[model samples]
Target: MSQSGIDLDRSLGYLLKEASSALRTAMEEVLRPLGMSVTHYSCLELLAQRPGLSNSELARGAFVTRQTMNVLLQALERDGYVTRPAEAPVGKVLPARLTPRGQQSLEQASAAVRAVEVRMLSGMTETERSAAFRILRSMIHSLRDGDGNDGA
Candidate 1:
């Protein structure tokens, strides 16, 4: 059988790409005044949520490589936004936590981030929004499973 025009696969891919780009642009605009990129904002948010997590753990959580995470950590440290506590007992890798300044920045950034999110979800009904979130999370889980299909 021959496929007709507007295949769902292609249409969905385009929609996802456009939505992602739009959201990223909105976030970057909100963060620009604070001299922060989306990458930096994400790192700060994650660190805030999981204080004292190791660099490797942070990298994994942030969906970045350890090298990329190291660079981000160095910048955060230089800006007095994060601190690596003194080494723990033998054979333990000391974890990093946000500094007071970091917490302050995060608080400020959170408001801006929330504004962006509100704008992004402006028109959706509550149930629609909930379903969309669930579907997206399920899609992520399926992709991470690496089964070469969306598992729909």
Candidate 2:
């Protein structure tokens, strides 16, 4: 190891960041022809899975701020992919849902994403892939429980 105070062999953060960057790049490439950024695609996917979610809820699911989500919602609406129904009777918030076009786009986008995922994991054996997934899930849970501190 170099004198960077971090052993490359034990630097999980570095490894995870590098891998995530690579995967994100690949996903961007795959989604480019569909006129969707990763953020937009993510929002569509979440909406498809949980229709009629509030904008705040969609933001949380997409790991973005409500303001950013509003921008995305505007773009989707312009593209005819999403819509907000009329406000509820008195005090309830109006929920957003995917349009039929949005649903179809999401289905196509999902297949593209899955293809990229499969290509990315092709180097790993099935057993290795399963173990890696389990370990990553554990790490995600740990980080969630640790109040966002990685303790690095």
Candidate 3:
């Protein structure tokens, strides 16, 4: 706390937001030349890894809304980067899959994103990186559950 209010310099939440913004900016810079946005790359990567994820599932995985995902999926299908069946095999859920072009695009985008990550962690030791992974995962779980404490 500060006399003005919260001390942002010392606030974990503020620091996290700052870091996230920086990360997003860096990723965007790298992905721009590859003709991909972070969300676009995320969608392709998710489809590659999961193979048959629904639009809603992809939206969640990409941290975007379903409408946004739907629009992106439409564009991707039009561009031949991804495909979805004309009719759902099940209840209105059309699972998305990346086409060969999508896979190739993802490879380039992934490499660019990986370079950003490597730059981000350039100075950190292996142990520190491992700890960071665990801590970030814990924070994510705690925030998702609406509790700051993970009982650790």
Candidate 4:
């Protein structure tokens, strides 16, 4: 080991966190005008891609607690952006699906988010982007493995 103090500027974990915070801030800037939070957009986007996902499933996907996702789902349903059956089809798990209004809203949010991502990657070469993706995934796997969370 080098005989020196730890340099946060060169710390991978610190850099990762800084990048994550910056990404979230950028996402919020674009989503705020549409009156949507990142979690809200993630939930809607998940439903759009995989209709009939349960609240718990969505919570897991969005990295929020089930209670938080449940509250958001209720609001979305009340606002007619999503619909749930009067009763769960089975096992008390109500599946959520986006309505036409939700789809339209998602279209706008998706465009805004895509713009942010495009700007983020504008300085990267295709090879660098590919390597970054692989490196991040490996880091996630290593961390999750140590924590005994296989992510199912």
Candidate 1 per-residue lDDT over residues 1-152, each given as its tens digit: 22666666568777898899998899999999998878788888988998888878888887789899889998899889999866664467658889999999988888999999999998999999999999999888877776886457
Q: Which ten residues in a row have the lowest lDDT in candidate 1?
A: 1-10
Model 2: residues with Cα > 4 Å off, grouped in runs: 1-4, 88-92, 146-152
Deviation (Å) of 122 in candidate 2: 0.3
TM-score per candidate, in order? 0.83, 0.87, 0.92, 0.89
Per-residue accuracy of model 2 over 17-121 as CA lDDT, tens digit each:
888899889999989999888889999999888888888899999889999998999888888999886666345755778999999998888999999999989
Badly placed stretches (over 4 Å) of model 4 are 1-6, 146-152
Q: How well is each residue in 1-152 modelled by candidate 4, as lDDT tens digits?
A: 23677688888998999998999899999999998999999999999999999999999999999999999999999998899999999999999999999999999999999999999999999999999999999999888776877679
What are the clashing pairs of model 2?
A: none
What Cα-based lDDT does every candidate model obtain?
Answer: 0.85, 0.88, 0.94, 0.95
All candidates in order of lDDT, best leading: 4, 3, 2, 1
Candidate 1 shows a clash count of 0
What C-alpha lDDT, on a 0 to 100 scale, does residue 75 get in candidate 2?
86
Candidate 3: residue 2 Cα off by (Å) = 5.1
lDDT of 1: 0.85
Off by over 4 Å in 1: 1-10, 86-92, 146-152
